[model samples]
Target chain A: MRALDVDYMLGLLPILLGYVPLTLFMAVVGMAFALVLAALMAVERVVRIPVLDIFVRLFISFFRGTPLLVQLFLFYFGLPQMLSFLTTINGVTATIMGLTLHFSAYMAESIRAAILGVDRAQWEASLAVGMTQAQMMRRIILPQAARVAAPTLVNYFIDMVKSTSLAFTLGVTELMGAAQKEAAGSFLYFEAFLVVATIYWIMVEALSFGQRRLETFLNKAHAR
Target chain B: MISVQNLNKSFGATPVLQDISLDIQPGERVVVIGPSGTGKSTLLRCLNFLDTPDSGKITIGDLSVDAAHASRADILGLRRRTGFVFQNYALFANKTARQNITEALVTVKGMSRADADARADTILRETGLEARADAYPASLSGGQQQRVGIGRAMALDAELLLFDEPTSALDPEWVGEVLDLMRKLAESRQTMLIVTHEMQFAREIADRILFMDDGRIAEEGPPADLLDTPRDPRTRAFLRRVG
Candidate 1:
């Protein structure tokens, strides 16, 4: 077996740095879409309207039951064959769409659980004060639910950042993609992959740190 | 200003309130007393449409609150006019005492934040919770939480206030503080309907006392007459047991 090439690996660091922004961009954009979609799905489940609730349940089940990688292929490769209009969808767009749908499903369930975790008497108390259902949700319920759901949502965001690496499989040149290309060209696979893994590990660690702070802040009211 | 006609409520096959009908005049203070599981709480909850009756009509002032005929908006409107205080206090655990009082004011009434805060501060002081205004519900004692609950209701400025076993959860020493607040509320002629096990508080503050059994009014009259000389044997037995 050949020894690892330290200099060559150190030299690839600058090249990999160029793809960092794109990786960050994908994660940020995916999170924005996921958060909005998750909030809507969470509210829908809470309201439990007749037919719409069934549709939301199916939506959540489908996205959460399957691997995100399969969903990405289905969206980027499979869907276009069925609907020609989606043929022009770029790798970046497809990756974001896949990430959003997958994460939103998980987020919806977490948020819904948080919303349900609130005391039932709060609902009665809110109604007793004359608040409409919409008013009760917007003013009383959501604010409280958001506090409980925030830490979990942040955890999902960290998972989302890691998941963005799958965009490399979709032919998007995110950090992992750049690392793979660099490793293949130089035949220093282990070194390039190690750098990529470190970057992801750092991102997740930073997010987890932030998550701890957020949980403490939100739970401040309950902490005697 | 409140009237109930043929009110009937049942949970599945079990009947809770049967043919319960009564009228309460404006500025009246009525205390409902009964054994546990006798539907005293259900009757009070039904009055505010919190627990919808299977059949009956409840008229508060001129507003009708029957689930069949009343629209959601109409029910909400009626609820706003009737403030309810619960046995457990039910203050939103996440909010401070001041925010708990001001939330409905700002959200439902659309008052400015400054205006809501001012009114909430006034009511907090009125309930003797001004010093704990910024405290969260978890930080407050059970009695203080109930005081905040009362302030939350009073902040709405409703025509009728409903108390469902308000002091039942408090320590015996703390119960006095809550009952004292109720005494002040009664003195101010605030029309109130209270369901309580505190016979002494009921005797001291209630203008009218109602003894309920199996969901029907067994007897009702001025507290003095009802407490000292209940006409119905059921009422007599209940009073004796509670005393």
Candidate 2:
């Protein structure tokens, strides 16, 4: 309503950008943990090993069915009530823990489906060549599965980066947190939020560009 | 180099391979021909324990495994001794034609990467795919893919090569190239057990042609005896239908 505060937003830009490292750090660490945990969960689902299969299925369903915000609250506020050790974890730890578990649920299903999508003939071919089960996975199945899973994995990573914005609610001073403070101080909510949104937009656009190049390179051999 | 005695396999109550007994000497080429679902493919798959036979004794070179009680080592030995070519080319889509050839040489045989690479070069040239050595299966034609599949099997140099309907999945135009490659391999006497529907090709390369029917080898003999004058009425009926 008041004439757009260009000077105010310009002053706020560096402050918002200053928190970029924390935001990226959360995203990077969360992704690494989620990818590994998702892979393990996917393996259990594929092999369906006894009692663990049921637990993994339920875990995936619970995380996927719940909102990321609610899951974050549960990790930060709810879980610590029951488990004493969780009380020592700061807001950043809780946010990372929440992001890892929440995104990994979705990732695990996609990963499992990708693994299953590989042609059965590949398994036979590997075995016929005297590959141990582990070799068949390492040399043949997983590599193919990883290619199939790539685009989806990249999509989730981008989404996870955006979801890092939610960490502001948990009291972590990420980009969104810095903007929230800047908006509170300047009373220029529109301009403050606008810059943060644009920064996120630029960030995602860069990721999308990278994803396109990766997909093209991966598709080269399969392209007819 | 491989012998199977009383090898039986069943899919839950329905028997797929029933009382199959056979012997293949080194350098022999045995071709099995029969109608679909009659266990011709199953016989080849069971030989490598891919289908996991119900009851049998399999002896390959000096290593032997019992169907019902094979240990991990026994099954691995069985797989190591025999190479299988699938109805589908089944080349690793992620691997190039050359890597397809080298994968087993390095993984199963424990050759160094350099040695495996060298072996891959030889196989690629032998299969006439030297020009396409770096090509992946997805980019290759059905014929080229099968050539890589054969090359992959060849690189292993197993005592026995088992082909389970190798050309059955190929396009009509692609079948001839694969058959030609197989004929070439046969000439080199690689000791093969091939299950094929290509009767004419069977007659040409077969030292022994097995006529399988109702989950059993109903009749078998040299190609001339089986093709010209089949002893069993079922064999005659089958050949008449296919011919």
Candidate 3:
């Protein structure tokens, strides 16, 4: 076995860092899309709208039941084969679509629970004031629900960042893909993989710090 | 004036409110007293269509709704004519005291922000919550939060006010302050319907007392008649237990 090359690993660090933005971009954009979609799904689940509720339940079950990797393949490979219109979707787009849809299913349940977790009294109070359903939701319910859902959302974003590694399978040269290419050329898998792992660990640590800060801010009024 | 007729509500097989009917002249203060689960709260909630009775007709001023056929617009109009104070206060936990009072003014009544702010300030002062106007409900004492709840309801200037166990959640020391504020409302002759366990406060403030038992109005009379003279054995038993 070749001795681990320290210089080769250090040289590969910048190349790996170069791809961090793409990975972060995918996670951030995917998170934004997923949050909005999840909120809509959550509202649908809560309201139990006639035909739409059935569709939302099936969608959530399917996405949450399947693995992200398989979903990515379905979006990137299978869908293109079945639908000619989807042929233009590249690996990055496919990965984002998969990430958004899959993670939205999970986030929707969290958001629904958070919304439901708001005191029933709050709903009564808003309605007692003559607020329409939309006004009550916009002015009262969703704000409190958003605070309850924020920490979980941050955790999901962190998970999404880590999951971006799977994008390399779709031929997208994100952080993991860049590290893999460098490791293959240098013939030093251990060193290259260790660098990528440390970077991911540091990123998650940063998010955990942010999560703590957010919780404190949200809890400030309730805090003694 | 407010009137409810044949108000019936049930949860599955359990009837919560049964054939409840009552009338309140303008500015009458009516207090409902009953054991927990007797549907006193359910009755007040149905007046505002909050509980959505299985079958009933509610009339407030010019607006009326039949529970079985109540359109959304009718429910909205009925609610707009009445104010409800929840048992737990239920001031928006995320909003400051002032915002909680002003939210409905701007959103429902179409008041300008400045006018709403002014009205909120005046109501906060009236409730002795001016000093705590900027505080969130979570940070306020239970009495203070209930005062905000009262203030929010009062600011609406609705034709009638409904309160559900307003002081039940307050500490003993805090209960006196809330009752004091409510006493002031009674003295001012606000048309109010209140559900509470505070028998003394109810007797002191109510123009009439309604003793609800087992989802029906078992007995009702003027405060002195109902509290001092007992006609129904159930009412006598309930009073003895709570007294």
- Stretches of candidate 3 off by over 4 Å are A1-3, B34-37, B228-243
Q: Write the per-residue lDDT of candidate 1 for residues A45-110, one digit (tens) a residue.
A: 988999999999999999999999999999999999999999999999999999999999999999
Residue-by-residue lDDT tens digits, candidate 2, A1-224: 46888988788888888887888899999999999999889878887899999999999999999999999999888999999988888889998999999999999999999989989988888888999887887788887787899899999999999999999898888899889888888788999999999888888898899999988887776776
The single-chain TM-score for chain B of candidate 2 is 0.98
- Candidate 1 regions exceeding 4 Å error are none
Clashing pairs in 1: none
lDDT of 3: 0.90
Name the candidate, 1 or 2, with the larger lDDT value: 2
Query: Between which residue pairs do clashes occur in model 3?
Result: none
Candidate 2 chain A, poorest ten consecutive residues by summed lDDT: A215-224
What is the Cα-based TM-score of model 2?
Answer: 0.94
Interface RMSD of 3: 1.3
- Which candidate's TM-score is highest? 1
Candidate 1 lDDT, tens digit per residue, B120-228? 9889888998899999998999889999999899889888999999998898888989998889989999999999999988999898999999978889999999999
Which 10 consecutive positions of candidate 3 chain B have the poorest summed lDDT? B44-53
- lDDT for B201 in candidate 3 is 88
Give the CA lDDT, 0 to 100, for residue B232 in model 2. Answer: 99
RMSD after Cα superposition, model 1: 1.7
